[model samples]
Target chain A: MSDTTILDQDRDAGFGDYFALLKPRVMSLVVFTAFVGLLVAPGAINPFVGLCAILFIAVGGGASGALNMWWDADIDAKMRRTVKRPIPAGKIEPGEALGLGIALTGFSVIMLFLATNWVAGALLAFTIFFYVVIYTMWLKRWTPQNIVIGGAAGAFPPMIGWAAVTGDIALESILMFALTFAWTPPHFWSLALFVKSDYKDADVPMLTVTHGRRVTRNHILVYTFALAAVAIGLGLTSIGGPAYMAVAVVMNLWFIKGAIDIWRRTDADSEADSHLVERKFFKFSLLYLFVHFGMLLVETSLTPFGLGGWS
Target chain B: MTQIRATHEIHGRRLSRNIGLGIVLVAFVGIVYGLTIAKVGTDPNDDLGAPWAQAQDKAAK
Candidate 1:
């Protein structure tokens, strides 16, 4: 082949392609929650140290994403939503992803320990392990309850963040962890309801694929109720205030209503509307978590003025 | 004579990767320096530090 022809077929991955392996979107959520967790904790942290801690935590989360991409490349290639990911898209090699993941995992964990405290570092390390090994490797393909249990990995960031400041876990941090843990199932299962075919095609036993859509919808409703309790319960904690309570109440009510709408619909109903309700619920779920965490930050900001948290 | 191209699409990708990595390294250095300063400037009587020193002093006595 001529040089031009050879170059055309090279398909060398770009910076963006490698960044995609880190799952930057998911990393953003981790960063945000971890930031809130650090800020809302009872103690204070140096601003520079806090920033570094969050950065390392985000890197740890992203490392797990790279590892997950490495392991799930096969199924990812089959799913339409993930087919264009770095590995499956032929832009990056799986081995390269594995290497990057391991390297970043080590670097982030060690740096986090040095920047903040052992508790934060250890939590980040555990989060990476739980997500990559437990969630991605073992539980994901094994059972329908994958999302329910695997959600713990995603839920750890805030706890880790709190640990960065306090060097210990507390009721407030656990509540923060529980809030995300409870939110994960409904957030994901809603998307699964609309994307059932993707899971089926990839032979992944998502709740929707293993159980019927009706059961999945029921699960979404159940989890949404649980999530509402956690969200409201968080508002009663030391980190929560009247502003947070207001956000929690309104968001949870809207979330529960969305879950009810999904639960009431059949496949036929969804088909007629092209899964409009499910899509809406899934989209709103993102906003729900963001608003909840944002309010917590607002509460923290209000503390100096004697307006934040319950005295 | 056949003309040779100066740059290929692959070059662009390579350049981007290099630039991205360069920025990440610079940021990493800044973070490490800042963290070191923060850790050094902290009070020895703070949370993680005080407990260890108090225990050591008790043992010595």
Candidate 2:
């Protein structure tokens, strides 16, 4: 075979390549949040049905990832962070990604409806639409607030999970959704502070690129305060307990300190340390969300033992 | 005569894809079966004490 053929063969898409189109890391967040949502809601679902609900919600989330990859392949190739995604890396055809995304969207929605209820199925469908159309196609390139609003797409899983069991929405689930929604802006803006050039080069209007890092830092600080309010407020809801309240208080304090550290620093300080505070804040944000949700799960587990929830 | 090798790079990818697809298909079948059993066993109409069915009966009356 010629050298060209050899190179082509080496680059041929594998099963893993197609799986990567689903953006598994992001899907993991979807799975976790949705699981917490289902379990914490005030209803009993069969363990198997609960598992299916989480699985289908994850699949729906992954379908949106695939669709996002398909729609954003152009700008994805421009960013160091996303350049190696399946489509941008040439491992999968755009049409293939589109087809897989559409196919999974349908299958997941229908299966979730069958296994759970129409509420969850409808929420999943709307999430796919929001991520693909509203976020990817419209807001991403057009506004600095892209992630601010686009965060809704990621925040829906818990609500969908709650709906799966209860077949309705409630304040507790809405609080869960609000916790993630409020968390997104700071979580993303912190990363954008460090990787500023990626969005600039891609011509995407990220807060860091559009408003400058100072403003981005300020936004992160403000949003972190809002997030703290949401987090603390969630602890007052039906799902909150002693454990969750403690976790919320401690994590929010730490998060606020990190945000303040980022806010107080000038570009000189950040550049001197290679954005250490920003990067640290970003890393802590991940743990922050996980601990909060994990505590909620803990509260639910303790409920049967009469230790969980406000009641 | 030129021999075609079974262990070519592209062939390996194809094989992995096939195996991955097989696992997913099997898992899907298992999930569907489990879901069916769960749905049927917990069906509100099948259980006299199910609050949901009682609520529905009350609403109908």
Candidate 3:
């Protein structure tokens, strides 16, 4: 179905093009969240082991990206936003991406099992499977709420990280997972609102393209409310402290206000401003997740010095 | 001109292939180092430390 040619390209594909298939931006989030999860747990990991766990987790996340690109090459070639991706741009073949993704997936999972524990390794494998199979192949093109269900894949990193330390999952890690899960819908929906055309042109079943902007906006607000609940609740947990609570309260307030503002705007208003508010909301959503996770890292690092995590 | 073009293409493919192989090699070494050569924490609860500490306690006895 993909029109992007695998051969006879005018120019040779470079190393960077292949690297781009790993979706470094998404991998960074996986790395950071997984690192926070590992560090904030109640035990000390060898520094090298912890670093290795994070690295493997990032690789697992990247493997998922490459597999996703391989499968979605057809839609990617059509969508304005994704047309520049390596596979879609004819820089790399679809089969090559699939092979690389599978290789990394196996490598990361097996090595993580050896370096850390089976629980973390299993979680990483499941994350890759869910993203590639459940999200990329099945739900993405078929459901308007693709991201809502697919969000679980992105939410598993911190849990995997936590498991890496304790060799088990617990309430604290689940709460961290919940934080990301609940945040996903609103973040992606806001982007979908602004870029509905891309989804429509690609024939993707994004909420905005299928249900219209009004419905998408309402869903964003609803999910934002849910996200705020999770974000604020996380602060009350043992791993979270006064510092986290402070960050959470401010960020959630601002986030909810942004969602509400988006909910009220007419499409005409959006168009007049060139989707400025929608764009700002989308950008803020990125910062929102980063700040929350960054606070967790800060709290964890400060704990040894008598300054973090619930006094 | 065709010969020159073909050689350039061969060189490009070789470069890309080598880089790909290099990445795989690096990833393999990193994983091996982390798995075999690396140590966890010094606490008894830490994975590597626990076994070694038990051994030391036995030898001391």
Q: Which residue runs does candidate 1 get wrong by more than 4 Å? A: A1-9, B1-4, B43-61
Backbone clashes in model 3, listed as residue pairs:
A46-B40
Candidate 2 structure quality by residue, lDDT tens digits, A1-311: 79998887777788999999999999999999999999999989989999999999999999999999999999999988899898889888899999999999999999999998999999999999999999999888999999987898999999999999999989999989999999999999888778746678888887776678899899999999999999999999999988899889989999999999999999999999999999999999999999999999999999999999988
Q: Which ten residues in a row have the lowest lDDT in candidate 3 chain A?
A: A1-10
- lDDT, residue A200, candidate 1: 77
lDDT of 1: 0.90
> Which candidate model has the greater TM-score, 1 or 2?
2
**Lowest-lDDT window of 10 residues in candidate 3 chain B?**
B1-10
Clashing pairs in 2: none
CAPRI quality level assigned to candidate 1 from its DockQ score: medium
Total backbone collisions for each predicted model? 0, 0, 1
Residue-level lDDT for A202 in candidate 3: 77
Instruction: Go through the candidates in order and give each one's C-alpha lDDT.
Output: 0.90, 0.91, 0.87
Docking class of 2: medium
Order of the predicted models by TM-score, top scorer first: 2, 1, 3
| TM accuracy, model 3 | 0.88
Candidate number with greatest lDDT? 2
The candidate with the higher DockQ, 1 or 2, is 2
